[model samples]
Target: MSATTPSKLEKMLKAGHQAVTSECGPPRGSDAEAIKEKARMIKDHVDAINITDNQTSVTRLCSLAACIHLKLAGLDPILQMVTRDRNRIAIQSDILGAASFDIHNILCLSGDHQSFGDCAAGQNVHDLDSMQLIQTVRHMRDEGKFLGGEDIKRPPSMFVGAAANPFADPYEIRVPRLAKKVAAGVEFIQTQCIFNLDKFERWMGEARDRGLLEKVYILAGLTPLKSAGMAKYMKNRVPGMDVPDEVVARIAGVPKEKQAEEGIKMCIEAIQRLKEVPGVAGFHVMAIEWEEKVPEIVEGGGLYPRPKLD
Candidate 1:
């Protein structure tokens, strides 16, 4: 979309500043107060809070509702939409709904498979993949038209974003895939959690060679290894996540009581190293359920005092 008045996240990226974004998940039950409490803790520490839409295929409160709650609470939220849950009709309708509540930033994703979530028998409705989803949002925002050629008088003014995995298999095609997303009109990208910096940098080099960095903002994904068990879970069970052996050893070397501290230290180091990478714009720090630790990590990583927008 041609942004008329940029969202805070868009303004920071366009200013060439190192932006910081974090995730805030909705609760399983209808406890809006709990969600608001979590957002209040880190609202000042991040450029925008990402409202996840039933992430990992687990059912939760709708992302649009949570985003509107966050918006009313005075926090800028990026409404995340997954293709697995809704068809294009619902997707576009929710996009308009989110905009009506003043939510401007959106991240389109092909969500996690249902088999991994609590319900294995749940049938997914991936009516549109990430590419088509990106195009759909652009049409609504820029063209002011629905997918079926209908027109909107005042369409949603949104800054579109998508997720990427530099560590995924057949690594040779990863950068080109990213180029394809950029070609599809994604204004920004947030990668899967990065533990293998060498591989991530290599992917960044490839993206730089293709000039994808110039076309879109790239926010390196980061998550601290909370424990040795957590590391093993990511390495063995999680898809599109690459936790290096050295990282495992670093966490394992610490005592059980101190593992979390060591993990945060490693995250801080990763942020410092990524700052020097050519195509890296900023970090999307996802502490998962450990939301309270975000402020410490952001301040420790030296990304605090997020750019002020006029």
Candidate 2:
């Protein structure tokens, strides 16, 4: 659904400026204050904030609730909805709920498997995969109809986005997969957190060759390493994660107390280099739960003093 109210994200990208966005993981417990606290940390620095829906399959406060919290705090929020937890009915209900509040930016995902999260016994509900979910949102918005061909009144005006993984296997399929998302009507793409620039550059080149550079806005994901141990964990433990060996060594070489500082430096470096990539549209700096570090990353990357949009 298109937001009747202006979206800073859509405006920034359309105006040809690189947009900056970040993710905020909602608290597992019922804590409205937690969401507000995180909002205060990065509200001034990012064009929009993405509130994750049960990320990593772990149960948390629903993304819609968190988005409302951010919106009430005067922040633009991207409501991240995963198909794993909800069926088409719940999804559409959430879309309507978010839109009524003018929370239009939504990121659709298939979600991490429940097995990986707190509820291993819980069954998944992937009634619509990521691609289908994207199409569903687009359908509801553009056609003014539900998935069942029923008309919808005042359909939410959503700025649609989907995730991409340049670091995923069978690199040949990465660009093709992205093309599918674009064809499904995604307006923006926030790629997997990138630590391997060479591989990301190659992916960008392929995306450009496919002429997708103009089809959608691409936001490269950058996460600061809070510690060398975290780097090593992401390198070895996280699926689809591609932390270069040298990067691990670089952070590991630093003293334990200073590794976080080094990680921020690395993130800023990634943003600078990505700016030169032809298809890059912006940066999605995911500082994880460490939201306080975002301002420094935005500032260090020379994205400070965010645009004063109306």
Candidate 3:
């Protein structure tokens, strides 16, 4: 369905233009100024700034508040709603509240398991999983009804997006998952940081073959490695993250001081290559904490001078 909100991200995708999105984590403390600073740093580089929700199951300034900061900073904010923390009623209410703030783009996620976070004892609120959250958002926006089936006097007009990991194991399930998200009414997808292009490409090829490409926008995910240590951590420690040995070696082969530069170069190359892929609608650059390098990567990928939609 066409987006019912004023979203440049949606406008670009619907216009068949490549989108460049990036991430910004809300500080654990009440640091609204920090949020605005990060926004100004990468504001011109991305189509939308994704404000993560208690990412990794850790508590932080809430995503909704951070999105308000982003909007005030003159940047488009994508509010991430994870079902791991809130039940259906709260999620729907937050969606309405977000729309009231003129925040329209929403990315739904099941979020990381609580075990990995600092608060392991937190309740596992799976009242609505990511899939169900997507359906709920669509229902509220398209049907003008809340998840509880109550009519919304003025439903939110939101541009919906979701996340995926083409590199995740049980690899065959990737494309099928993509299909399911599209069927559930996700307008775009942001995949996990990709280091294994072969696996990602194969997944894309299968998705293309299945004709899913035409139905939804797929933004290939990219994250520049800060060091050999970071690469190793992602490969061996992060769940469902696929970082190839060659990637680790390449970063390690470089001098410790230069590893960051090497990682950035690798990210640039991936962006360039994915631009030619059949199903890639754009790129979602998850720069980790390295927001300073987003513009360099976007420019290096030849996506600078972000498109202006009338």
Write one digit per residue (lDDT tens) for candidate 3, span 223-262.
9999999999999999999998999999999999999999
The superposed Cα distance between candidate 3 and the true structure at residue 139, in angstroms, equals 0.1
Off by more than 4 A, model 1: 1-5
Q: Mark the 10 consecutive residues where model 3 has the least summed lDDT.
A: 1-10
TM-score of each: 0.97, 0.97, 0.98
lDDT tens string, model 1, 163-234? Answer: 999999888889989989998999999999999999999999989988899889899999988998899899
RMSD score of candidate 1 (Å): 1.4
Global lDDT of each candidate: 0.90, 0.91, 0.91
lDDT of prediction 3: 0.91
Mark the 10 consecutive residues where model 2 has the least summed lDDT. Answer: 1-10
Cα misplacement distance, residue 241 of candidate 2 (Å): 0.5
TM-score of 2: 0.97
Colliding pairs, model 1: none
- Report how far residue 220 has shifted in candidate 1, in Å: 0.6
Put down candidate 2 lDDT per residue, 1-310, tens digits, no spaces: 2333367798888778889999999998998899889989899999999999999999999999999988988889999999998999999998999999999799989888898999999989998999999999999999999998999999888889999999999887999999999999998999999999999999999999999988899999999999989999999999999999999999999999999999999999999888988879999989998999999999999888887654
Cα displacement (angstroms), candidate 1, residue 288, comes to 1.0
